[model samples]
Every structure is written in C-alpha cells, then in structure tokens.
Target: MSYIPPHKRQTKGSPLLNPTPAPLFNMRSDFNKFRTWNIGYTDHTILKWFSVGLDDELRLSSLVSFQPLSPESFETKSGIQPLSLVSTHQGCNEGIKNELIETPWLLIAANVKKDLLLSFQHMKREMEEAVMAQVKPSVVARFGKILFYGSSSIGKDSLKLNSLTETTLRKMKGSFHTDVPPSYMDYVEDRVAENLGQEYVQGKELYYVKLSDKLRTKSIVSCKCTVAKDHNKIQLYKIELNRVRHMVADMSILGKSSDLRLFVNTKKIKMALSDEEINEIKDLIASAILDSEVPSGIRWPLDKRHSSGGRYVVNAIGHTTAKSL
Candidate 1:
C-alpha cells in the first residue's frame, strides 16, 4: 500500500457520548467529547454522582434534559445510593416535594431497591412489559442513517486504509448509466417488432452515458425495458382476480404452483429432481427480465407448476403465471 503522509491522514474524531445510551434514538449528537482533555467539566462532576457505569439519573450528555440533576424524580430515577432514599424526608412538605418529583411518570420507575418489596399487588410495566411492547422500534433506521446512508460500492470489500465509504470507489468500478444506446434500441426493436412495440419505440431515443477513462472501456449499455401495455392490462386482470375472488380461483397445490412463494415449498413439484434439473426446467420458461427492475436476475419457476404467457414489472413474477408466466 502507498503511504498516506501526516497531513493526508484522517484523524479520528471523539465519539458523541450518549448520556442515555438506552434507546440511542432518544438522543442524537453523534460524537463523544466528554472524556478528552478539552472541557469545562471536572471528573468529580460526573464521578461523584454517577457510578462510572450506567448511572442515567443525572443526565449529562444532552445538556438539555428536564429536571436533569434530580434523583427524586419519576418516584426517583433509580435506586442507586448516589441518589438519597426518600424515606429520609421529614414532613408533609417533603411528601409534597416527592409527589411533584414523580408527576412526570405514568408509573413509578423500577429500581434495585424498590423491586425487593415482592408485593403481589404491584407490577412495574417497564420491567415486566411484554417483550414485543418494550422494543426500541426506531433504532435500526437511526443506526443505518448514521453509518451507512451515503455509502456506495459495487461489491463490499475494501482495504485501502479507508474507514468512511467512498462513492468514488463505486464510480471506479464501471459505468452505471441510465442512457439508452442506439444498439440498445436496435436490441429492444428486435425483441418486439409488433405494432404496439413500434409505437412504444417510435419516438424513444437512446442517450450515451459519459464515463470516466478507467470505466469507459466496459460495455455498459443495455436495452431498457418496461411492462408492455397489454401485459400491464393482464397484470390488472390478475389483481382483479384477487379482489373479486369468486370470478377466478387459484389452482389446487396438487395441480399448479399456487402463488405461495418459498422455493423450498415444492408441494406440486416432482420430488425426485436435482437443482440442475430444476434450473433446466425453469429455463424453459422464457423470461425477458426488466434488467432495470429485476437487478437480481431470475431464479424462479422452481418446478413445473405454472404455464407461461404475456409481457410481465413482475412484482411477484408468480402472478399472471398462476395460469401463465
């Protein structure tokens, strides 16, 4: 590998220390700056109240939490000793203060100490809530946005001392352009020489996609395709069949490949066939793939259960093919 000099080297930035790493989405700033030597805070400010571990009661990272430094909130944020026990209170005023502190919570926050009461009459929903209910639903989307939203690649390997994704690397791979070439038009013309085909191609022209010198040598042009109008109408018929069910019925599993999708669900298929034999049989189902749409090529008709016909967005290539492919 070539050397990357001092000025060219990308240095690491501090992580955005999530004060409450609980759901992560509940907080935002993505760089950590708390531990580095540049700050107005002292270790005692954090260490004196928080246990160096979790210790969320004193929300430190956000700098904008409501009643942030109070332990006597939400019936006390937690039972950690750093926050004093409320039983030490001395009057009706103290009870009033405690009630005011707990006003925000719908229910009391669970704690190591409070849970030991073992009162069968009580339940903490946050702790004992159904697994499905307490799940952090938005975390996956948030994480994808932070680390991979702008990433690009042809394949997924990289070893050039790059940490962040480089879109330039994808441009380096080969030309990926939308321009339709003249030969591509001819190719498309050859496939559909009918009246409707001529009408579709009558004014449609191809544009050459310019490319970088490294990728210009690749044969990147290919015919673009779309669902033909008549085929599209057939698809509409298929949708109509589903909506007005009494008019059309799906063949029995023993008779044809029902719209059921799993390739392994070979109910109507002959059981003795091997993978090569299956691919060979499926090959008999001539398909003009919408390369722009079905970027992941064809791998269907795993058995001899459906008939073939018509032009097909192929959202579920299984449709139209319940009777035809």
Candidate 2:
C-alpha cells in the first residue's frame, strides 16, 4: 500500500484505515527478545544489542523501584500485599541448546575475604587516628609545670596544612560557615578584673573552663594552651562588685584574723573544706575584700595591682643557717 503515489489513493477515510505505526522500542520477554520496531534514537537507554565473538561478560545492574501508583489506596490496612524478587531460573531445562550459566563473579568475589578484612582494618585505624587527634590527650609529655603551648584558629582562607608547632596547635575551630566572629577576646575582661571588690565570695570568682564543642568532626587538634583566650590581649578591665554566696562565705572579718581559708566554686556542699586543706593566697583574699564604700573593708596596697601572679613563699624567722638581708 505504501508503494502507491500519495495523491492518487483515496483521501477520505484512508488515514483512519492505515495500520497502527510500530513503536520505536518494543521490548519483549524481559530483554529476552529486544528489538527496535521503528526509527528513533535514544541517548543512553538501550534499544537493541547483540554479541557474536565478544569475550567481555555483560553485567546489567538496573535499579527497579516500584513506587505506589496511588499513595492513598496502596497504604491502606486491608490493601497490604507482599512484594518480593525471586528468580526461579526454571525455564532453562527445556532443551533449547542455550545452556544457562550461574554468575561466576559472585563465587570469585567470595574468595577475597582476607584482603577485604585487611582493607577494612586499615580504614578503621585511619578513622580512629583522625578522631583522636581532635580530643585532648589526658597525658601529654610536655605539658608540665609551666604552659609552653598555645592554640590558634586558622580558617580555610589560607588552606594551610594544620599542624602542631613547637609552641602552638594551628587548628581548633569547627567546620560550619558563620557570619558572626568565631570568638571575641580583645575586649573580654581578665579574670582578676571580673572578681574584684567581691567580699569573700568564692563562686563568682573567674576561672577557666574547658571548651567542649571543639572536639568534633572536621576538628584538627585540641587546644594546647592553658586558656582559649590570652589575658594580655584584653582591652577592657571592668571591675565588678559581687555579693556573698552564703553567710558562711561572708568571712572577711574571719579571713583577716586567720591565715587559712578555702575558696570553693560550688554554691552549697555538705563536705565543707577543713582548715588543714585550706590553702589561702594573701594577695587574692585582700583584693576580693577591698572596698572604698565600707569602712571595715581592707584597703588595697598602694603599689600592688588587684591581681597578679603569686607564689607560696616562707621566710625563716629563727633558723641558725638563715642569713638576713
């Protein structure tokens, strides 16, 4: 019928009488018989393929996901149906001359158990090392009496390799992007300035606390310093007056009389510190109680600062070997 000229044939119902056009790709029998029925070109999907003398084995791995056609109906309690994938491998004994062969790669891959285990162990060791590098070591070889180590945060702007130098740990921050500053220290008051004029109040005294969030994924090393912020860089030194935690802590008069007292951080505890365990620093106790408003308060020394490094010193009063200046 297609050999006839176009205009010469009947034009009236001829279009309807024409046979149905064949499809571009009419796959049959689950790729057992794959054929292109009509002229068309697809980008990556296979239309038809065959092998004559090729040696390479063909392994077709396709994801077959059966999504619910109707979400509202398929998920009903009464509509629950079992779904599974099972290959009977049955129709092979029909004497078709084409022998069925089991997948050879599956058995071959099972022999690689020893090498696979070794590779897994190697991966585990590397991962453990990376994670432990971010944690603070409980026992460091060189963190002795004096702190010689420092911590600095270097961001991705430089992409420098993180490392531990003679005096510093180069990276201790996190991996998230942020607009706010990482940390503020230039204007933060020092420990001494924050606890001044507090009359024997122990809990309000400033102390360094551990930074917990820096031990996480994408972290490099724990801070190697005694402090996260340097006190010498402080620009503001605001003096704040604090109140006593308890009547027991309001011991300015008692402290002035005795040379021993304990400065505990807890607000309340049943196990009170004894006089034997109390190790009082004269410079610290004087600074905490010094006040201009109260007449009974201790007046601070003229030349001495409110806070500074101190030592536990003792002088010989009557020892025969002692020499006087």
Tell me model 1's lDDT, rounded to 2 decimals.
0.21
Q: Of the candidates shown, which would achieve the greatest TM-score relative to the real structure?
A: 2
Instruction: Flag regions of model 1 displaced more than 4 Å.
Output: 5-225, 232-300, 303-325
Candidate 2 clashes between residue pairs 3 or more apart in a chain or in different chains: none
**Predicted candidate 2 versus true structure: per-residue lDDT over 171-280, tens digit per residue:** 22111111112132212223433566322222221221111112222211111111114322111112111111100000001001111111111111113323432232
Decoy 1 TM-score against native = 0.13
Candidate 2 displacement at residue 13 in angstroms: 80
